[model samples]
Target chain A: MNRPKKIKPWWGILPVAIFLAFWEAAARLNLMPGHLFLPPFSVVMQESYHLIASGVLIENFLSSLARVVIGFCSGAIAGLIIGGLMGWKEVLNKAFSPMISLLYPIPALGWLPLLMLWIGINEALPIAIIFICCFFPICYNTAAGIKSVDRNLIQAARTLGAADFRIMITIVLPLALPAVFTGLRLEAGMAWKVVIAAEMVAIPTGIGALLMRAESLIRVDIILVCLMVLSFMCFFFERFFLYLEDKLTGQWNQHAGY
Target chain B: MPAIELRNIRNYACHGVNLEVFSGELMVLLGPNGAGKTTLLNIIAGLAGYDGSVLFDGAPVDGVSPQKRRVGYLFQDLALFPHFAVASNIAYSLKANRWSGEKIEARVGELLDLMRINHLVSRYPHQLSGGERQRVALARALSLSPAILLLDEPLSSLDLHTSKYLRIELKQLQQRLDITTLHVTHDLGEAEEMADRIAIIHEGRIEQVGRPQEVFFYPANEKVAAFIGAPNILQCDKTRALGHGLVEVTCGGLPIVVPYDGDSIRKIALFPRDIYVSLHKPPGPKVNRFKGVISRIKDLSESIRLVVHAGNNQLLAEMPRHTFESMGLVAGQEIFLILKLAKIKVCEGGLCEQGDSK
Candidate 1:
């Protein structure tokens, strides 16, 4: 049952509201010439409405969302398969762990220049960038999850007449789910950042592309609108992933006990 | 014929194990920690590799896969599948053996009723209490009606009352099912309570195997005597052979006779229950009589344990609380003792390390 009396989050919202109000006031009063750089809240809202009405904002948002979603999914699938194998089999681990560790530290966006050169500013560029960013965490977490399955459970399953493959499917995979989810969440965040970076570098239609174009045109309001839209998208996805994690882990924890 | 047999099963630094358990008997593999009892069970379950052969009903199963080995293992932790509900966990082994859906359902239903866990069919392991989890695990292991049941300290983790109750339940169930069961535990009390035959394992070797009363009274070696709960072991420095499986020995300057084939036994063990304590002397001073002062008294709830000091030797004597109260026993009081010479266990000749005392 849900608790009836809840602590209002108005206190948490106060600081952000105050900051935005201060910005709006400064822009409206034109405190200084540089006030142009900080547009009023009304101006930002008008710019957002115009973009939405013209369909630019929705199209660009959809474009960025698609890239991130597709890239993240492909990368996560690959990571789970590869990492599960690496953790399950010693030979695969010995072969791939070193390479993963070596490559993990390098930011996925760092490959943008080389990728752009090879793939030439197409949709592939951002997708590849996002995929690169998502892969490492997903792989690492999944491997750690698989490795974390208790040895006793496996032995028990074997004695219960489960073959090696059945043991892996029934015991190993389920036990590793928590860790796999952890990897997916981390990769999703990284994927969003990579998509933005790649789009800013060279995308025909995306929020990141709009932000760059607005930067060139010196349209501070449109830039701020684009920034806010991107942030809202990221926040929404983060909450969605968190809810998914909570539901799955909550079910798992009930089964696993303490 | 034996239900399960381990012949020269040596692996993982365990000593050579040659043991057998007959059909329809609850065999308790008793030992202290690091005794390789679990390893022996693992070897029989085909979970651990061993050099020698394991036979079930006189058939060699050395090459059988663990999946094909019809031995149900109940681990110390139970190892129930946490993600599955009680019914599914029980049905898991059956499904693995390729049982059809309807058969699995029927089998799970049967096990649920048998284990009295039908009410918990849909409950996850975490949702159940310790005893419930234990029963569910047993149901899962028994789903396949295994050739032999291997219980690896299944009752060790429960509370005292639960362990005691479960011990009786396990015994009755084993009898009803007539399943050859090999239960491993370091708890001597449990072994005494449940084992139809007690296999005394030590350092990976089965030192002795016999009925509960036999192993308790007539341990074949010093290791078995020490491991069993013999509170009084006397040093026999000089021994002379007597006729026909008897030995006369001088223990702590007192001569006593013991039943044995040789004169090489350097020590003899006496249970506290075998010794009688009295305020006045009424018998002859022979192999069974001694004079000692009560050094310490331990209240054991149901019974009292009294340690007697006799000529640089500490002898333990146990009696009912009613007897202790009736005799007005107290520490530092001098008393006469009788050890019942016929009950003296002439331990097999070897250096036997004493297991944990009490």
Candidate 2:
């Protein structure tokens, strides 16, 4: 297991640096006709600094983060339980597979009107939407992971006098961890996207609300700041899940070429 | 150690199979591909369902769950846990059986030392070599101190040199442990080298069970004979009855004498090892003797294989490497050969005959 050489972190940000430089140059030279909507990179940076000084950016960012964390955790836990059961038991899989297939294709926002009538447009609304968005991919990926486990490992465990529950805990779950992590990482990105959309429609306290407020004021600089923060948050979540996955199932990933 | 007995075992992949493995003996189940060798082992370990009764030391274990059967099984793939290190893999059975932490650790240590893999305790399955992985799997299987051990083509995955080395090591370990064992393999040479008693299985049925020599030299029927590597199988061209319960069959212009039964023999299988070759004609009984020219020679490390063109038939003969070197044999040279008359197998009907002379 010879590991690949370490890559410098600054190399990854080079493209962003080049893009910002081009955008600033284009704006200063009046290269675009719709320059009002496309603010200069320096202007967006100035607006970000002003929002942070006034405490509005930190407050709104924390609100979105809290909703995502809570919604993602709850949805991920439920998905793990249901998906594990469905994968392990044929009867459960047969019973739930049709329903999952039908519901999985429905976008998270499609349930917004129905959910608003039931739970109302409150903080709970955005959290619920994020939950719906996170559940499907996590659930489906978890089940696929469990189903992909080698039957030989289970049989070997049985021959060693391991009971069904013991086998599930010691063999099945550990083997499926890599897949579970993949599901979690996918759902983490989706959680951020869904939460932002839900906040724009149903709440007024998150970064999505801040973006909507900026749009009404015709402040392109503020809108650009929100978009940059959201992009950074998504990247952060992806790296966080990747680090967790590597910590838990690094040996398996290396051995299996995952 | 307990003797394992399978009485009237019937499954999707097994017919009415009745086999008895003596206590503390390594019994090999020898057969060709898709011969239900693995199915039989699964039945014994209680991993597969069957209608017949499985008994350990005369006590029925037909209703026992696989977890409660107390059988050690080394699968053909080795099935070592990829995630767990060598020590953890061996300790898995102990942990599953609910041993205390101290006991588990001690047992794992003993197994690691016994398998001579103490240096690989922290290494994962993928980190170890093929032979090292095999040793770890063996140690894991033995951690529970099972009543009987079942090995399903355990050495089939390794290269020739490694497989040969591990075969002798496995046999020696099995002997030292004095545990009842059932080893399944498709290799006739492996069966002959390691088995105390060899059972020939074909098409989900036990064809014959006997000592290695008995099953290899005197296969009960055509299927067993063909599966046991009789390289000199010749189709008979004609047959004539000789007096005193003897019949002569002409095959490819060569006349072969076999003990007469009323049934007609269509083909005869002669083991390569049964054909004796010499440079000079010896003064002895002249039965089944012919002079042939060596058409080809194959060096097999331990033995030399010679293709002899006798009469109109090309016959294969094997001799010890030292004997072959001492005789200075070479291709295109004329030699005298003798086929042991009593060892020739007479096959009736067809190659795919379904008779079981158990």
Candidate 3:
């Protein structure tokens, strides 16, 4: 006599629902000031609704997403090119490392003033900052990935009459793809962070600008809503990138040999 | 033109060694570890860079890359591509060779059927067992229909039972494919079972090359004899020379007749299987018999190996286990031994000289 397993929806939603309920109750009971430290959850939701109605929040959200897409794409492309070049040729990697290090830790914000003067404080500045910040880790990891492809795979490919280019395309690239995807995921997250910082510095029509606007009006609820929106967007991209990574690396997981 | 030939083939590991392998012949290279068997195989495959000339059908292949050499190499590790499925892996070389799409598909299918792994076409390397993967690797190497095939310890990774089965499959496949193959293995049984000609390599050179039985019976030197399972190697200083191809050497204070050339060394060698044991202590006529003390007895299923000390020479003799058991063979018991003069081979210089067994 096999019994059906009981399902528990409460356990599934317990942590988030419990925390939100406690927050709403505490704010409504006037345990803390509702304007700043303890803004009512309902008030934050109302501000979110008002912002969406005015279309400002949607524009800013779309603009932020656009920047992330452009910046992440550019970063990934540059990383793949430079990383592959460096990984294949030891001389190139050695020559490029010092230059990469010089610019890596400059933070997207630190470059805002200079980029605004050179490329202007327009959308280019923010996208460029994101590109610069995300490029290093992606390229470095990609080079490492290429270098780490099994030597036996290369030898086997060569002995099987595969020429240099074919071996690289068929054997090297596929084996390096998993490591390359890891770099892309890491760079995607970095793109989100750096793009937000870029928007905060130079862009006036983005989620970061929304944060700035909330601060100016001293609307704590709107500020909290904007921060939460940023987090949600990051979460979405993370999950999307993870799905891509899984698709690429799932083959390696199933095939344990070499 | 020979199917393959290496003339004055001097490399870092093998110096001044020449070899010629015939088409449709299965040549086995036997050597202990560090004897450069794999190095020689790799050189023949053009996988390792060498200064010597390797010719296929009279044309020198020294300048050609291994890929262009039309030589298939099954590495000892059997490096299979993990990302590709079984069929894709086997078809990789065909695709690389620019074969037509239909031809590639047909060839891969035929090879899969030949290797008896058609059902595993879509499965990856990890999904297959060791023996299955080995067959897949072999199929992949053979995909392009190479001119020659080189196998390095093909069955070493397998267990005894699987190795036995694979050895049979490998021999059958080589004949069916009609490709000249150089199979390297340290197992003497594998050589005896598969080789048309056995080349026993020692210290990076071929010591003897002949039929398996010939190499075993007539080793070029004492080292070669011992390595090929020869049990009794004795140092016999020449005592007297009787004309007509015979020399009398006194061993164990007993005179024995040995057939030797005028420049014969004072040493003689005998394999354990060549020596016979007898129960009667009375001397036998027309057969060279010696009194020996059975020092140790070992039961080897169908046969028993006895360690007997005769004439200051410790001789190991393999006899029927039933005969030994019926005789109630025990240590410290005196026994009579008949040395087969036809089986005793004398080295030129001395008994214990070292030489390559090719």
Query: Best DockQ goes to which candidate?
Result: 2
Per-residue alpha-carbon lDDT of candidate 2 for residues A1-258, written as tens digits (9 for 90 to 100): 999999999998999899889999989888878736777899889889999999999999999999999999999998999999988998999999899999999999999999999999887888888888888878888898898999999999999999999999988998998889889988898899988888888788899999899999999899889998999899899889888888778875683222
The ten-residue window of minimal lDDT in model 2 chain A covers A249-258
TM-score of chain A of each: 0.90, 0.93, 0.89
TM-score of chain B of 1: 0.70
Report the lDDT tens digits of candidate 1 across residue range B240-301.
88787877888887777788786486778777877889899856646667789999999866
Stretches of candidate 2 above 4 Å error? A1-9, A255-258, B231-270, B273-313, B317-358
TM-score versus the correct structure, for each prediction: 0.79, 0.82, 0.76
lDDT of 3 at B160: 82
Which 10 consecutive positions of candidate 1 chain B have the poorest summed lDDT? B349-358
As for DockQ, the candidate ahead, 2 or 3, is 2
Whichever of 1 and 2 has more DockQ, that candidate is 2
Per-residue C-alpha lDDT of model 3 across residues A64-112, encoded as one tens digit per residue: 8898899889978998999998988889989998898787767656777
Per-candidate Cα lDDT values, in order, are 0.84, 0.87, 0.81
Which prediction has the highest TM-score against the true structure? 2
CA deviation > 4 Å runs, candidate 1: A1-36, A246-249, A254-258, B232-358
Predicted complex 1: CAPRI docking category: acceptable
